[model samples]
Target: MPQLDDGSESVEMSVAMLRRMAEQGVGAVCATSHYYRQQNSIETFCARRADALDRLLVNLPEGLPRILPAAEVAFFSGISEKPDLGRLCIQGTRTLMLEMPFSDWTDLQVEEVSALVLDRGFSVVLVHPERFCSSKGNRQKLRQLEELPVSLQVNAGTLLHWMDRRVGLNLLREAPIPLLGSDCHNLTTRPPNLKEGRKIVIQKLGSAFLDKMDENAADLTRQTANATT
Candidate 1:
């Protein structure tokens, strides 16, 4: 097993994932496992992630897409105060994939994220902001994030779900750095479907917009990879 986040549980799954992503014409991927601060310390989380990555890399099958290790760290009060918070950033870059709180965000919470970007030297990426859209205050806080350096990532399921599709498109329009995620959990029900979201993006935002999105994604990973390699 790869012991990776989402449903990438085994080498067989990796092979399956390669084919699945190929269908979407995706050439590279970020293995962003979840990091729950309540359950583990930074050292513990990194150790586990390293072990899983080692296991996966050792037995990796041929033709697998490039994998960049990262964590989707859940937000908590005073998280920016944690000295090791930078350890959670994506490998080779100071970009943190922040999973914003599901409940209404407070000024303190938003300020902490600001501190991360403005003070702590981190480029924060908010994962699946559409999930928090129902709360009016959350929506406003999302806007507040615009003042700071941040990226908004919408899930593929957002466009896949009819109820969320319109709201997701609107959210993308308001995003500072719009990114899309598959958020695939398993082989069935919830699965890799960035292709579906790409279709929606083209319909709503035009193919050129989606091309820029792809270029943005490529540029980010390529820059980081070049920096480290």
Candidate 2:
């Protein structure tokens, strides 16, 4: 648990983190730790994530947001075919959060991500594409990903930051995004700020937009309320 978030201090991070989410009225939180194919097998990563989550659940703060165990898997070749990939989806759902490659994407790379939807039947959510926004080629590639049954997510910090807000807002205008995340890491610095970000969205995009975002979030985590496993 301490190891998952380098600054977490231990399972106490989970306790403190969720309490903050509760204070903010967050109903669900996706605990998506980083997963790199080059460093570990899916089975090993899933087992370790389960153990970390178990430790957190033992003393999870009462009335806090619901936890959805998942991974922000870094993309790689043939990931769609990973036999244990489904195990990494948010527990009780087929939604998967993915961190795309930092380098310029190749057509094959795009095709494999499409395969994740068309062939593998996984609903892939691309994490924080606004951070990677630039270059017409990349935007075109993202548009291609959008053509599939894929969605993009924007970080709350991206909208809240004065410097990044323009880019963040522009993405909202141009991209097919149905998700917004707190992307909270610790109690301070990169702490949960979904409320603050939503405020910006309300001012810029209106309540109707925020309502749609909340609806999409509910749909994505629908089974979480009833999940026993």
Candidate 3:
């Protein structure tokens, strides 16, 4: 599940929910780092990352989701200066989840993220897209990333969203399907949605796809746990 934009104060609740979900056989979470107020200085961002790590290790229950610290890193020109980039990539993840900016981004922005991932020895997982902004046919845009080995993950909830439901469903039908995440943010408004997402996939796609998600999610967490060790 994606972590919220709350500060260090909310880390405890995040850990608790992760524990509960893990006990119920949900083994992994794509923990987003947007909550650290990264718009502040890099020092502040890294401090929040440290606080999140401390809380995760201390309060995390055994046999729960093996927490993998990641970030929906905002990809822009000066992200190279963001200290949290190194922390998230080196600390727990070989893959960094990046969020596209609100506006249509230049090819240079995508290339920059890909290059950073390579420089840090990390792969990239581009998170929930903003409509046709990143579509496949944008040759010049995609050509910028031709050399980077990246995973493009689309949100399952997008199928239900009013804006991208059709596009989301179409992508779901495509081959080499991307990983599905809950992208969950809050308790009430945008709750952890993997369960509902599972139901949706089973209904629309089939039980076989659901089985794949179950197995894949387990393996992903196990790999992350082993990496952290």
Candidate 4:
């Protein structure tokens, strides 16, 4: 799910992008298109995402990485309480990739995550904490989340850029980061740079760091498979 909204189409997944991911050593990709309540209903978004995936798969060449169904759902009030919220999680998994609000988080917003985890029994993966965790208060909030059953996913692009590289490195050093994603959009703007990102990680933290992350990802995927079976 590299380029959900590539500006050209509603969902812009292509074989070319898949090839690029394969070249970069991406074995599987979760197609997490942006999903906000204001845009459309979950039913509508899932239907559109399914259609886009179908279009991509029908024309897909052999030996490309597998695309998993998921969505990068935007945070909103009372989201956890929604009975159908589980439907928006990554298919066959209880994990939900949440894009936190850009503005200052409210108490209710923070509580929603706790409810999602402790009450709803969902594994919450907060996406790209570097973006919102810039402030001391927000960073503290992320630390609080670590106390709960939550995971942090960093973007490869963040680790490569000079401006955000320190933030990402510091987060990895201080917190428990279990996953890394390209957050790729297209070939031109935000291409798949996972290889370069991995290189940086190895250079800074050694290969063991990446091995741990891979183990965590494997565990998550295995749990998903087990649940489905």
Q: Model 4, range 16-113, lDDT digits (tens) per residue?
A: 77788899888987778888988878888878778778877777788999888888899988798775776677788888889999987776788899
Error of 2 at 66 (Å): 1.2
lDDT of 2 by residue, 86-117 (tens): 77778888888899988888899998898888
**lDDT-sorted candidate list, best first:** 2, 1, 4, 3
Off by over 4 Å in 4: 1-13, 223-229
Q: Which candidate is the best by TM-score?
A: 2
Task: Please give the distance, in angstroms, between residue 200's alpha carbon in candidate 1 and its true position after superposition.
Answer: 1.3
Please identify model 3 stretches exceeding 4 Å from their true place: 1-4, 7-12, 35-38, 41-43, 60-63, 78-84, 117-121, 130-148, 161-163, 173-177, 207-229
lDDT of 3: 0.57
lDDT of 3 by residue, 1-229 (tens): 2132652336566765675556445765656667333375546655666676776677666676756666667666666445445455424545566665666567677657766666655556666653434545443454455346554565767766757766665545542324567676655555566666666677777888767655544433343432321
Clashing pairs in 1: none
What's model 4's lDDT at 5? 59
In model 2, what lDDT does residue 58 have?
A: 86
Model 1, range 45-120, lDDT digits (tens) per residue? 8898889878777877766677777888999888888877767777787788899888889999999999988887
Task: Give the residue spans of candidate 2 off by over 4 A.
Answer: 5-7, 224-229
